[model samples]
Target: MDKATVVRKVILFSALAATVYVSIGTSDEAPVQVKIPTSETIQRPAVSVPGTMQVAEELGAESDGSDPFEPRNWVPAPPPPEPVKEVVAPPPIAPLTIPEGPPALPFQFMGRLKDGTDEVVYLGRGDQPVVARAGEVLESTYKVISITPTQIEFEHLPTKQRQVLSMQSN
Candidate 1:
C-alpha cells in the first residue's frame, strides 16, 4: 500500500483502540440503580361516585321518547325561517306640471283723454306719467290692446296674456 494510506489506517485503528480502552477502564465503579413505576402500584385520584351517578340519573330522566342509538328515531331540525324581503316604492311615473302665467301689471291708471279719433290713456309707473294709445307698445314689454273711459286692456308682449287696468276716481 501507499505510505499515506498506511498512515491513515494506523490512525483510525489507534483511535478505536483508545475508545475501547477508556470504556473498559471506566467500568471499575458500581452501576447506578433507577426505579421504574408500574400502573398497579401507582396511586390514583379519588372521585365522588354519588355526584356522577346523580347527574347520569338526571340526564336519563330528561331524555326524549326516541332512542339515541337508533338512526330511524332521530328528528331532523326544521329549516331556518325565510329571509325578510325589503319592499321598495317605485319613483313617480310623471313629474308634476307647474302652471304657466304672466306676472301682475305694474301700472296704475290715472285718466283718459280723447286724442282725435283714437283715445289715449294716462298711466302712472311709480312717479312717471306714461301716455299710451290703443295698439301702442309701452316699455317694450306691454302692448296696449284697447282703451276705454273706465278701463284699459293690455297684453304681455312675452307671454301674450291679457291684463286690464281700471280707472280710480277720487
Candidate 2:
C-alpha cells in the first residue's frame, strides 16, 4: 500500500528463510570425538618388493633390507694375465782366402813388328804376328812416329787396318 510498509515486510520474510536453511544443513549428529586427517598416525609396511606384496627372495637377495641402490650383493670377478717371452738372434760369419786384384789390363806387351822379325809378346817371343784382345795395346797398330826417347811421339791404339789406328791425338 504505502512504500515504507512494503519495504518492512520484504526484509522480515528474507530473515526468516535464512534461519530455516542453516538449521536444516547442520542437523545430522557426528560423534563428539571426531577424527581430522592431519592428527592421525598412518600405518605403512617397512620393506617393499617392486611389483608384488611378497619379499624378493628368489634370486638370493639378503633381507637386511638397506638401500636398493647399494652393491652389497653382486657376482664374483675374473683372474690376472700371463707374462711375455724374449727372442734370441744369431751371430755373423767370416770369409775364406783374401781375393787378388783385376788381371793386368788383359794384354801382353808385344814388341815392334818390322825390326828384323823380333819377338811378339803374344806369340811367347816367337816368329809371327799375334792377335790382340780388346783393351790390349798392340805394337804395330800403335807407333812411335818420331823418337827422342824423352817422350816418343805416339799415334796410339784400336786400328781396324794395321796402319790406320791414330786413336790418340798427340
Candidate 3:
C-alpha cells in the first residue's frame, strides 16, 4: 500500500525473474574440464633435500637390527611394574602373662558363730550346708582366711586369689 513497500516488491520480483532466466538460459560454450591425477600419474620432486638423507641414515643406524614389524622383536612392557606389593605388618603380639584367676565362690554366707577363740562361719552351696573356720581348708579348694560379722574372706587354693562374701539379708 505504501510507496516503499511497492518498490521493495518490484525489486524482489526482478531478482526472482533474473534468477529463473539465468537458470533456464542456453549457453553456446561447453563446460570446462578439470583433471585430477591418479596415483600412477603423480610426480615426485626432482631435487633431493640436503638433510633428509642424513636423517634417514641416522634413523637406520640407531636401530637394534630387529624387524620393526616383528612381534618377537618388540620389548615387553616391563611386566606391568610388578603390581606394587603392599607390605602388611602382622598384628601386635599381646603380652604373655597369667590370664586365668580363681572362679567365683559358689557359697552364700548363711551366718557366723563365735566359737571361743576361732570364729566359725556357715556357708551354703545350692541346698547343701557347709561349715568353715579360720585357717581351715574346705572342699580342698578354698581356705577360710577370716570371718567377720558383716563379711567373710576366703582364699582359693589353686590360685591363692582371695575373695570376700558379704553377709547381707535379702
What is the lDDT, from 0 to 100, of the residue 133 in candidate 2? 33
Candidate 1 residue 60 Cα shift, in angstroms, is 88
lDDT of each: 0.82, 0.45, 0.81
User: TM-scores for all candidates?
Assistant: 0.40, 0.16, 0.40
Whole-model lDDT, candidate 3? 0.81
| Model 2 ranges with Cα > 4 A deviation | 28-170
- Per-residue alpha-carbon lDDT of model 2 for 108-153, expressed as tens digits? 2343333343322232225554543334444544443432212223
* Candidate 3 wrongly placed segments (more than 4 Å): 1-99
Model 3 deviation from the true structure expressed as Cα RMSD, one decimal place = 14.4
lDDT of candidate 1 over 9-47, digit per residue (tens): 999999999999898767878876887889987877554
46-135: candidate 3 lDDT, tens digit per residue: 555645445445556555555444466366656555667899999999998866988989999888778578777788999999998888
Best of the two (1, 3) by lDDT: 1
